[model samples]
Target: MPRGFYTEGSLARLSREFDVFGPLSSDPEPWMTAELDQHAAAVCESITRDAGAVTLQNLSSYLQGFVDGCRERGWRSDSAGYDWETLRLLAVCRLAKEHGFVR
Candidate 1:
């Protein structure tokens, strides 16, 4: 992700449940690794927030589409690395679920 492409404002609501780490920068330094994990955890938590209310079959289907979208967008590329891609995918999944665009 580009610097400032995702801002603290985008994650304001998530701050209550998880640390609001800024998005990956254009030339992200190694120090950002910790924040990346935090961001991913937040996204995962948010995406799974309604897990109990959602059917396993539906959740699995949604998850497949979510991961496929990420891969199609190159969010899962080796260039982005495992951690970065993990966070990116989780974040997108969370946002999609929030908007009712995904399960």
Candidate 2:
């Protein structure tokens, strides 16, 4: 299995750090070395298709749009919180590299 692209960019590091240090901390170590999951991959595909292409130059904008959309509806319920925010960052980084957007 291939691992996701590991960019040394601030966005990538932010995701990993948030995942490891956030209140709902998760083990991103496995995600770092493992193949991208189907769900994330599928989301990435849809985003790429819908957005017409995501590159490092615009990744942050996409991230902002995601957060804005989430906030527009509801980012949290009783069961979940901001974990999806961090996960989306990680997922975007993963596919960004996979799609050669990170270079």
lDDT of 1 by residue, 1-60 (tens): 222222222222322222223332233456555555576456557546856444334444
**lDDT value for model 1:** 0.44
Cα misplacement distance, residue 6 of candidate 2 (Å): 21
Worst 10 residues of 1 by lDDT: 1-10
lDDT per residue (tens digit) for residues 16-102 in model 2: 544444322434455443433643565656667877666665666666676568667775322233245445655665655566654
lDDT of each: 0.44, 0.51
Model 2 earns a TM-score of 0.46
Candidate 1 clash pair list: none
Give the clashing pairs for model 2.
none
State every prediction's TM-score relative to the real structure: 0.31, 0.46
